[model samples]
Target: MGRHDFFSKYAPRPGRLRFAVSRVAVLALVIIVLGWIAISILIAPPPSNEPLATVPLESVPTSSQSAKGSASPSGPRVTVHVVGAVKKPGVYELPEGSRITDAVKSAGGLAEDAHPELVNLAAKLIDGQQIILPGDSTQSQNPNLPAPSNNAKISINTADAQTLQELPGIGPALAERIIDFRTENGPFSSVEELDAVSGIGPAMLEKLADLVVP
Candidate 1:
């Protein structure tokens, strides 16, 4: 075949040749559009079914934090010495509002010969307080005579004239004067108040300091 001979022999008209060329161009454009759509579908990301993340607005306290916040405060405590006719006598620690009876119980209760009626068991305990339980020996003794031992200090506010005379330098006249002073002025608040009495001087007070308590 020679150049341009095949188209001239098959079509024979210029109008037919132009119509075929337009039909071929339209089919090529349609194929290019379909290929472009397939390429976009393959490269694009897929749709997701998972939910988005979010933060809470308020926080809740943990177990330790809740326990700390709800905890109650404890009451105060006091330490005292329990002596004399209890089953076991020693220093003990107790709550602030504890009474003498409670201290006795803490010391294993009163001994067989202890005279519980002589002591006010309901009295409230204080820090550094000393409790002395009188026994059968003490109950049998006469109140006018001095105690066998000087280790126990006499209470000036509660002691009678005979008991007051048990202290050093205190005679019948001085004991009467101490009783008169306390009777006239009311109970002594402190041992130092004994100086207010006419006969008791600084030297006498110094000597009685360790032997008596107000």
Candidate 2:
């Protein structure tokens, strides 16, 4: 028999109607769920995956530390003379903040006969300061004159920075400069060469003329 004629002649089963209704309901529910998901995605998008910028603690310097580093002063050197019983008495270039002990070391340290009690080793050195050791009088031009004597005229070229300071108006700084000039350009040929040193003007040269020997 034909399907239309069979269906029309036979009564439909009660279970078939229920099965069709349940299938339709399930499909409608799935469609509704899918639409809801699509709407949510359109409303709220995913966040970007970029990282935040951050400086490491170790890389950053503290305010006090940076200030301390910048606070230090450099350069600005001064000259000082170490004389008397030092092993090698001479003029020495030193930092502006240097002390007498530092200048003494540069002059090759004190000799055994040095009178450590006379001079202040801990004192701060100045541009033209001299350290005269009491027992070092043997260095005087005339050994027979006695120790601690300055009566003999100092030889400009042969004298150390300390001895040169004996000249009028000549200090440790000027004495050092003179020695440095002498070392670089050989000994001063005559007292007239004193003019080459910046601080020694005509009047100073005249005063030093009778005192120093080339």
Candidate 3:
């Protein structure tokens, strides 16, 4: 049968209320689906809190850290003597890594006319390194002056502690010890014997060979 013919023949009577009931049933199904969706959303737990990601801003230099963190815990402490044209001259205690300038500063700074050129200020101070401040007039010339050669010449055999301290790498304490050794043990048989003294060694003897005498 044609759709129009069928609908006309089976159309609900107004008093029967069949069309109204069918519309109400579809509306109920839509409301039920909406309610179920809303309940599912409200009843589910909120998503778990997540840990934050982090990154370091900077890292320390490995070389520098290792350098500062020395393998050995500590080392010997030594004192060096500073004398002559310095403002105040005397013995100064120093750690192994201290420098010549550090010792000079401890002795109260260089004299007004100290010869800075004669000594290496940056040299790493070894145990017993004496730093001397030379006289202002050392560079001058006068007939009354002793031979220029004499001024340049340093005699370890007869020179006092102050003079001996002027030698490279020799400090006032070592100079005094040398003098004492000379007094007690007799003049060094050869410059090499200086190593037999407590603080000196092959390296120091090499530095002193040119400056020492029989």
Best by lDDT: 1
lDDT string for model 3 (12-112, tens) is 78866877888899999999999999999999999878877788678666987878886687677767777656787888888877767787888888888
For candidate 2, what is the total of clashing residue pairs? Answer: 3
Off by over 4 Å in 3: 1-75, 137-214
Candidate number with the higher lDDT (2 or 3): 2
**Whole-model alpha-carbon lDDT for candidate 3:** 0.67
- TM-score pick, better of 1 and 2: 1
With a 3 Å backbone cut-off (N, CA, C), the pairs that clash in candidate 1 are none
Provide the lDDT at 73 for model 1: 77
Better-scoring candidate (lDDT), 1 or 2 = 1
Residue pairs with backbone atoms closer than 3 Å in model 3 (clashes):
130-171
Alpha-carbon lDDT of model 1: 0.75
Write the residue-wise lDDT of candidate 1 on 1-214 in tens digits. Answer: 9868977687548787799899999999999999999999999899787887788778688999999989987689878787667899999999888888899999999988776654457656656666666666543553322233436667665455666777899999998888778667765656789999988999999998878765
lDDT of 2 at 195: 99
RMSD of 1: 12.1
